[model samples]
Target: MNLSVNVQEEQGTAVVYLAGEVDVYTAPALKETLLPLTEQSSTTVIVNLSDVTYIDSTGLGIFIGALKSSGKAGSKLKITGANVRVKRLFTITGLNEVLDIEEDQREEV
Candidate 1:
């Protein structure tokens, strides 16, 4: 699977777009991508998973780890654009209550 990341900064928020499958082989890269941003400042991080096609346990671990790390650092992490399959994973795993996930709304401010 292919992985692509795009980062945008706005009003102290860091928006990251994740495109592709997140599995054991690629979860490390995703963790690496977020570490620097999380360490830089106490910015609210929004990870957009609209384009993510698949995710494995390792992928889920990275997000959970990031959430803990961000919490300790006094920052917040939000997950957005999770498709039905992904959302089901979160629900089935009881992760939906642990992570902050938002719906996709095209309007921009």
Candidate 2:
């Protein structure tokens, strides 16, 4: 599937659910969706990646930039529900220790 993003609110947090491939061709769109949230003070952004089929190095670069941007703005970005492949990428890049990467227990509604 082509990359798509769905924005929603869960409790007081802003959640962005991503589906399909996130590659050199699609990372820019994800960056746009996240840019505003990154500037918000005390914001908590949740990136739900359960439906994401693939992601390349460029996509990972975007996530890393967002993580740093959010931190500087006093905001937080958590990556949740990444599949085995994506999770392995995080571990391989040593981002698991720097970013809030977690397996989500909540089912999609």
Candidate 1 lDDT, 30-107, residue by residue in tens: 999886676655699999998998889989999888888887788889999888788888889999998998965644
Report the C-alpha lDDT of model 2 over 56-104, residue by residue, as the tens digit.
9999998988988998899889989988888889999999999998875
Against the true structure, what is each candidate's TM-score? 0.89, 0.90
> RMSD for each model, in Å, please?
3.8, 3.2
CA lDDT scores, all candidates in order? 0.86, 0.87
Task: Locate the minimum summed-lDDT window of 10 residues in model 1.
Answer: 100-109
Q: What is the lDDT of residue 79 in candidate 2?
A: 89
Model 2 alpha-carbon miss at residue 105, Å:
3.7
How far does residue 82 in candidate 1 sit from its true spot (Å)? 0.3
